[model samples]
Target: MLWTTTETNETLAAQLSDELRVSAVMGQLLAQRDLPTVEAAEEFLRPRLAQLDNPFALKNLRAAVTRIEQAIEGKESVVVFGDYDVDGVTSTVQLVSMLRTLGLEPRFCVPLRLDEGYGLSHDAIDRIFDGDVPELFIALDCGTNAHEPIAYLRELGCDVIVVDHHQTKTEAPKGCIFVNPHVNDPEDAPWRDLCTAGLVFKLLHGLLKSRREAEDPRVEGIQLKDYLDLVAMGTIADLVPLHRENRILSWFGLRHLRANGRIGVRALAEVSGIDASQEMASSDISFKLAPRINASGRLADATLPINLLLSDDLEQCKGIAQELDAMNRERQGIERGIAAEAERRAADEFADEPGIVLFGEDWHPGVVGIVASRVSRRFHKPCVILGADGDETHGSGRSVATVNLVEVFQRCTDLLGHWGGHPMAAGVSLPTANVKAFTARYLESLKALYPAGLPEPSLRLSTWLEVEDLEEGLLDELDRLHPFGQGNAEPSFGVRGVVLEEAPHAFGEGNFRFRMPAVNGSRTGVAGIAWRMHGVPEVGQPIDIAVRFSWNYWRNSRYPQVTLIDWKPSGEN
Candidate 1:
């Protein structure tokens, strides 16, 4: 599909380019993202640790820190309960590791994604409370909406500190210190969109500051920056917006990871085929590192990755990393088969519907979210993929930015047993009998929201650049905007009037790599590759393409090139 490029202010771009000594294209890209001044551009292009906001600014930090300090000083045990995914596991490890510096060994537990389910569940709590009742329990990446579970923990004779980043209900869990940004009504807070590990970092920072204020010597050697490796992995894997505070964390975190000191992180990179010497990006975390960490949680216990992250033994970390790698490969195989089946079902029957909801009698609950994401992207609609077991069904849904899945679920709450998550991604469970009603009501809600018509998916083009322009060191210039993800997307440029040198040579069944011939008055010969692109342009055809300029590494060096995002015949634009 051809993209609709938003008009950018040439005046602003030119001013920034002249002031900051950046290329015109980089200036335009920065302007489009709302960076108007030199200071904003500098902050974004080169984020420094000093740019991070004070930890005390986050709401409830003082109270949460005091509570944690009281528990530690009194020698009371604390249990760290976290969610099963990367964010959750990393959060657990971060808090536990920090607590150990204070002469306290904290017990922790993560709910099984396929069994005990998500976030402060009764089974996980029972498992944690089995041996001894802790003085305080900390819930990470969860417990924001877990009122009953929090109440139950209170009954178990311990106060719970809820350190999370998920959406909350009208009222937070009673009597718990709600450190979540959503519950705190944080206004214009740069760290409002923090992931669980990020929140844990804040919590630890607050604790460290409190201890330092009292002249506690134990806090001396605890460097919070040392933990950014885990923070970067969780931040990128959690898919939170990588701007503002998060950009700083991830930017520094990647640098720390490249230092290769931690056994688990280094082993994970090695087992996942990441070179130790190469400068890694956020994409490395998203595509290479995180999946291996998340694979253990998806298929088995999340504690496996947490153990790997916390392990100091080189051989132990390597063993765990290899096991995680094997599990990730297995996960890929299952995901591909399930995605193919779900896509076929959506194409066959869910085409006319606004939301696609599918359930299998024996689907693995672990992979449902990935399937929903694929289905939603393919059909350009909200998708809810469910797993049915006897009378109950568990599911996950992914949606476009325009549609609010949380609101959609609230309207259909009468039929759902429980549901919670952000606008773009959510989870739900209900009686198996209500699947039909859910399908109908979900589509109806989407229809009401978009009465005009369901909008087609369109890519956002950053700026227009001719094929010849890509050869001019733009990729290295783009490095200033490192660690692109949710908010900070890698720039996409439109290239026009490029002729293919020959019929693209197909390397795989669904992809091709070939050369583009020069245009009149241009020296733009370059290699191009398109994956799963339909209507493959024939030899000698003039094409206008939407592409992203990126580095393609070979022989231990990075080379600049353009990756095709979308394309059309030259006149289509």
Candidate 2:
């Protein structure tokens, strides 16, 4: 969709430059986020971890901490139960490491994606109870909405502390202590957008603070910043918003990650061939690190990633990293095949529907969510991809940014046997008989919620750039907005009336290439790639383009480049 900014808004942005006494570029960027006052502007520019709320702000914080402290004092066997994803693995690592430092016996456990299914399950809990680990289970990133299994655990006298960030239903599990932001007060802290790792980090902060107050200097030098790398890895991998506390955590975590990297991180980097000297970005974590970690759960046991993260041995870490890398390749093969099949089915089946819901009896539950996400993005609709096994059917949902999917599930609570997640992403399980009913109800609820036209996608441009401003200095100035992600995105500028002086270089025999343009009496090069646009651009045609200044850094190579977002040939001027 074509987008044009308001002249009044542009004037206000210009006025902000004068008020803040900063460059117009920076002022306009802040103005885009709707920063009204200078105080808010300062806070936005410099997010302090100290400015973050106390960890005790969560409900039942004292109860949860007291349980952990009792376990530490008694030397009771504690098991840190986690999920397969980055957020889950990191939470396990963070909590396990902290518990060990506090003189507690903590072992980690994770359910396999294919074999055991998602979150806290009755079978896994039963097995743990059999192991007889003093009935202490601290679940991270899971177990928030696990009503049945949690109640079963309670019957077994097992205590569960659920540290999660997923939205909860009104009828939640009767947990030992549920520390979720969505519960209690909504206005407690804006950091509720944090991933599971962020929630676990807050809990650890409380534990550490208590230990330090009791004259434990051993906890003094233990900087939680050391684990910011894991926090950054998990937060970015899970695709959490890089805003507020998440932004602060990631910004600082990325810096430390580059400097004092972990063995598993270094090994994964070596396998992926990423240099530590170069700064790590969110894309690196999402594409490279996260995939390898998640591959463990897809093809093998989820314990592999947990082992890799918590291991202190270098050789073992390298072995696990290489194993995960191998699994990632296998996972890619499966994901591609499944995604292709899923797309075909989606196209054939849901051609008329505004929302998509597809189920296959033979589909693997391990990778359904990722496939669903791909299909959802391709179709630009909310999707629920289901995989059936025996009488139980599991599904994952990915929604467009406009819809509140969790709310839809809340409305269709009767059809869903179990459901929990954020607004845009969710996981569900139900009997095979209920798939059609749930899908129909879900679509109906969505239609009722947003009867109006869906909002058109817009490219938020930071500035309107003329050909004259395509200088090395201007690109350098743009680099000030570092550590970009959801809240803080890479700055995009519009270059209007620019002629494509030459045919684009179609690189790698794929859907991307660079364009050579002649503007302002000079030959200025810009990188242009049609991600899905295979048709060639007409030579010598003037087009309105959205572009971002980017740097391609590799071994012994560094250069400025522009990533083309969208371009349409223009008749104006």
Candidate 3:
């Protein structure tokens, strides 16, 4: 596979190393990440809650907080309407928890994905209200583009606060206290890239600050740090960039996750076979925890996970966690079956095109997004996977770095109904009649933009490392940047010229494994595993490899190992 390596400035790295009294490799890694100045590097290395920007920086934060405060103080009813995804569920949990701390019982509703779709629907509001509508409604992770809903809420004498991160129109929701950052220039906004959970944390921060300033003793003992566990789950699950407060939240939240403070999260870890008692990382949340929480929303009602998150009873938490675990298993089976067929069809259907769009009547709508992402990554091109029901079709697309799925979908809006998302991923709906036309337009856009066809994938290398550097000590030094994801990816190092200790061989999974001597001249030779790899070379094959250095960990034990990204014959560099 092709790769791109970042050039290192030896002189600058040396300067940083001498000043910081760290390894040159650590200095270079920090430099490559653009934390050049001493203060910047220091802050990046040691993110503190004190360093978080003022919560009032979020647009409309004060207004939202004041409205909530009034509702609580007056004993008025409140409702939390949120999306069905992990972000929505977590944000709902966060906000509801804070409201309870303020001494108000808040009613919260999560839409059934199959029935209500995304955002605040009139019917959903009606269901949540029963007869007497809440005095105030807070919409989490959705409702920014909900003009009609906002209007309907006003008619019903309800105030609305939209805490969302999705893109919104210039006009904004009329009279609704809009809190999204997308309406303004995020280039200078500290809170722009935060996911809804992060936004909720900021809102809580503002409320706590105002309440404490006025000498409110009730808000005194609330640590706020205890809630970081939920915030971290949502941040990592939602794929928000791990920068600024997100990094701090996730970094500490990971600690909270490992401590397993929340009964629900602890039960989830146990049911999912994750030893959460040990230190947890971002991948654990992404792979183990997020999927279980998301499965509730995808395959069934999202309220299950939210209830689990809110519950304090161990028995109830365990039961919900098991149910979600089962749902996740069901979701996986469905996703695997769909992905297999989708890949086969793509191999034939999109053999020559720069992109692909496919739909099936029997496909599960909830799992199509995952398959779309998988198809896009597999083919390394933009892909749209649709689930058809009667005459209407809803589809989601995942884009490569070369193409913006949201932008492309917008250009082809003439063929779509409701559509919106970020640059890398998007959702769309239209009549099944226009599916073919939409597919054609989508391919046309891709062909025009990437006329040369899909470009070869590039494995980005952060730095080159000798096998000797794969020591337990280096892991500690590199871990100054923890909870790696999105904007802050775990560094992938290039290791040149190592002879295989034995013939490479495939395991039960597609991963290839072998051992080689530790170039650091240590007594013990280090081992490596290359996932999703095929075609093994003979013993003593001199090879240069790209690897991510980390601990090969088990219960109460850890040893150094390199996870290979790619490899070539020796001397290729």
lDDT of 2 at 277: 63
- Clashes (N, CA, C under 3 Å) per candidate: 0, 0, 1
lDDT of 1 by residue, 58-163 (tens): 8888889999999889988999888888889888999999888898999888887776766778888887688688989988898888888888888888988998
In order of TM-score, best first, we have: 1, 3, 2
* Model 1 stretches with alpha carbons more than 4 Å out: 518-524
Model 1 TM-score on a 0 to 1 scale: 0.97
- Tell me the alpha-carbon RMSD of every candidate: 1.8, 2.6, 1.9
What is the lDDT of every predicted structure here?
0.85, 0.77, 0.84
User: How many residue pairs in model 2 have overlapping backbones?
Assistant: 0
The pairs that clash in candidate 1 are: none
Better of 2 and 3 by lDDT: 3
Candidate number that wins on lDDT, 1 or 3: 1
Local lDDT at 216 for model 2? 75
